[model samples]
Target: MDMTLKDLRIHKGLTQIEASRICNIPLRTYKRIESSVTYLNNPKYQYAFELLDKYVVNKNNECSFNSALVIGAGYVGLSISVLLSQYLDVTVIDINKDKVDCVNNREPLFKDKDIEDYFKNKRLRLTASLPNKELYKDKDIIIIAIPTDFNKETGLLDTSGISNLVKEIRTINKHSLIVIKSTCYVGFTDSLNDKNVMFSPEFLREGHALHDNLYPSRIIIGGDKNNKKVKEYAKLMQSCSLNRAKTLYMSTKEAEAVKLFSNTYLAMRVAYFNELDSFAMNHDIDAKSIVEGVSLDPRIGDYYNNPSFGYGGYCLPKDTDSLITQMKSISNSELISSISHSNQSRKEMIAGDIINRLNGHGVVGIYSIQSKKDSDNKRYAAILDIVSLLKDRNINVIYYQPHEMSLDDFKKQSDIILVNRYHPLLEDVKEKVYTRDLFLRD
Candidate 1:
């Protein structure tokens, strides 16, 4: 099959510079290939394509799964259910009636354009139902996509939900391949009593879950790599994805570590940039300009470099803390511990800066409570913490959310508005707004 340079780069999970280096070509030459300025017959283009071909899936080796039951209606589970439904008889099980109804009605529980489009146009062989013992026994594969939220008091991921689900699955079905897609502590898969159990780490962004799954950077499956069933499951996933992402098989413990460490590293990068933005802001310098200069190094590309209140999404905070909890026995954990601290400090700095701008006594209007724009999920959002901090200082606050009040009314009532990210609605009251969103993109 023919492939574009852009497709190859995304499949290999490499930046243009990295891909160019691997192909032994100049950056400009790679750009030309990526932009299709260079013809496919060109020697350099052919060479680059040949190098990327190593990562592509062999379509002839694809496998088919008859049936799959995915647990949870959240992003990870829902997206995986939809993807698998294209080729397999997929049933999504959720405890929440609302979520089940929404899926049954061909509606997405959350805001994802790709999912919305799929529901509108595609004839998916998918269904949703409440948890039942018979359903577990009927499916050929059982996927555990339940949430394992980090319990702050326990200092670890609350894996009770996963553990309970695994037990129930084992009791009902001894033949199904049980895959754990939830984020868990290291060595979580090995601790499970079932030999058929596996851990497959999911890397998806909020509001883009399905799209990311369709064109994933890489697919990592942890379990018995040599097992025929495991290999078949991996190939099934490969055939289902749009990109046919590069697949890796490793020990269960290593796969779990990959999930935690991958998220923690992203958290660290966010903290690093936030600290840079903080320093620039304190010294009255342009944070954006500094970031642009720094990102030109190619090693630190421009993606995910935008400044925010802090890294407060579903995965980063929990995964970082979970890693810290797992690394307690290790001697050198200062860097791991410091990532959480840096994030907290970043939020505190933002709150303090907003307060300082208002002279400590004024109505602070919050634009939205969601973690980021285009996302309905506000769990662990930094703005919530900032609101609490402002409230403790006896500062009056109002939410400018459209659901709560009209934009015209919100503008008239608030003395100052605080937005985590820039928006066109805040353009009218630019002088009254306080935000760290310099580049305007999320």
Candidate 2:
């Protein structure tokens, strides 16, 4: 089969318009090129490959890699490894033994639906402990997908993991192009001064991480242009992506800033809606009705306007907090900081309200701590703030969902349930329960 430019571009997940913009050509011209009628003679097409490296695990067919090693078993790492396994011999390395074992057994670590199939067919090799340096020592690419959590006290991500990992990679495998998928502050990759280093931001949501990887919104790759390795790395990454999304290449610091600012803006939007809901709630006004009316305007749109206690997730809370702290020299991010502060206040108020509603100290049952309805995770869940607040007031905060905790005695001792969202079995304790889930939906 004669592979047309459109076929290659589409397999790489690029729309004609996106291809045009990436190639710096007219949309009409790009369309004809993607339609296979014209050969893509534009030099800008090379830029797309660099951007594709930011999002895709392996380039489609441009680069030859005998084996690939991915560190970290978290959602981003797992997703990247699975995608790469489709085209290359891929092995996942993580410090967590259970996570590696689970992946080896075809078990879903997080709530991803597509992970099992990736494992069942023996596509990706999963392993605990460090990847054998002698084995991946010759691999073309070694991706760092480890968690870089923001320290609550320092207002910066604890990139010690990344730093150490990079040092190890440099010591063990100096030639492998190191792609950092973990989110970090702006100029993070620049500080390391590694010509092979590239900052690729992950845009995957918690529950739909793999699916998002399968059909990404866009791919971005950023590093210094002087580094030929970075350019080749980007090309390899673009070749591996879904092949239909647009890939944009820029500098490393710009990629880092894009990740932080993107999340901060989302936190700002969440805060905006929560503030609106709080206003409606205090005045005994119908929040949903008012929100519906406001969202009907085409300019504003309707999605992501739902009011919640606050924005608390693995990504939003730390990213916003980190961005706020990183704004020491910059003066423009005050509004973003306020959005994060507003979320904290909302959580405090929700806890206070629940506490005040209770007549006496009883076993106050805490429902699913996961902010969203369908998720099984509770790390950085907003409900934990409620737990802390109520505990300070001498209320017994008994957690019912063991999915988030190791405590086994929780189910046996709770008289009053505090659920953010309601369920049918909660009817028995309905009179004693206190919740802000007025509409019974997330």
Candidate 3:
């Protein structure tokens, strides 16, 4: 029996509008396609049909690797190291001795349940060491998952570490396939001028790093797609993932573009919703109602729409700024350029709202500093920006995180409490709590 677009969409748990949006088609066109009014031969519908056909759940036979070396023990590196160790003899090298010790002890340097579980339950053939030529030489595959933080002064991604490391790796081991998992500028790999090197962008969320690696949505390997080593590396990654995610091969520059564009789009969505909340606040409208009403439209769905002080985390701020910088030479970068500004405006708006609520003359208590609930990372957290903005106005602020202080004591010490996300712990003091967390979720 032949399947229609609607059938495929329904099977995927998507509504017609959601499917249309995914296919980048109009609702009417999608309706026509579903009703068999549109011909499959039509060029407009061909790509959508192809996309649907390619949407099959990927299931591939497991592949194995003999040995691998992963540099950097940050979330990306550590998770990849653990995942690969399940099949390959993996060695993780980091500059930080504490991080190495933590990994050696089977303790994650950061908060991640999956990593903890893997350490406890899995017989991972992994070892941690400081970078050395001896450790680098014997590895069949060397993966670079180092940080490339955005440099505000240079107005570009700081790839100095990546550049220096690649040079060192080449010196130590000339034949090992180098896979870069770091977020870098577009054309960075092309600039390296090495055919043996490939770029494979990681798509793991903070706090859920290992879980995401195990059940990835997709895996993208960017390099010589026809190369045997490249294909083998892709297969190895696919086998490690619990889902056996669909893998895509493209040029390195395209892979870099994919990473930047994907993150920027998420940042844009966050800024869009924050702006919407700002508008609602200004107009005295119900922001939650507006968000819910808009989200009911299948195209919008209902994830990552929660409003906060701003879109501030390790990735979004830097990635968005890097993408904006990358687009400087381009003619039409208005929308891309506006994302960072929008995020900044949202932070300012949030601060202004809090100040207005306090009448600019009361002790304020900060609930937490982490970017998101249950996350230990405070890197570029939106709440930090809001706190800075308030302090600039000479408003005295105190903080009480459950991690640091008791809730009863926190309530007694503050006149007004500022919470980014509402918690049940604050229920007793809800009257004194000021928050924009309408949905009560991250």
Model 1 Cα lDDT, one tens digit per residue, 192-288 = 8667899999999998888888888889999998877888888787766668688999988899999999999999998998999999998999999
- Over 1-442, each residue of candidate 2 has an lDDT whose tens digit, in order, gives 1335555557757677776676667887666545443245544443444443332334454465656788988889988887777666677888788887876777888876666655664345444445556655877788889888988777788788888888888897877888899998887888888888888899988777776776677787878766777776665655555545677789988999899989998899888888888888799899889888999999898787777778887999889888888886686656866877799899887776676667546667776678777666788988788788888889887666557654334444665566666766667556756665555666
Identify the runs in model 3 with alpha carbons over 4 angstroms from their true place.
1-64, 401-404
What lDDT does the true structure give each of the candidates? 0.85, 0.74, 0.84
* CA error at residue 60 for candidate 3, angstroms: 11
Ranking by lDDT: 1, 3, 2
Least accurate 10 contiguous residues by lDDT in model 2: 49-58
State residue 413's C-alpha deviation in candidate 3, in Å.
Answer: 1.9
Q: Please tell me which predicted candidate would have the highest TM-score against the true structure.
A: 1
| Predicted structure 3: lDDT | 0.84
- The residue pairs found clashing in candidate 3 are none
**What digit string (tens of lDDT, one per residue) describes model 3 on residues 12-121?**
55678877887888989887767776456666666776565344232222343589999999999999999888667889999999999999999878888888988986
Model 1 has a clash total of: 0
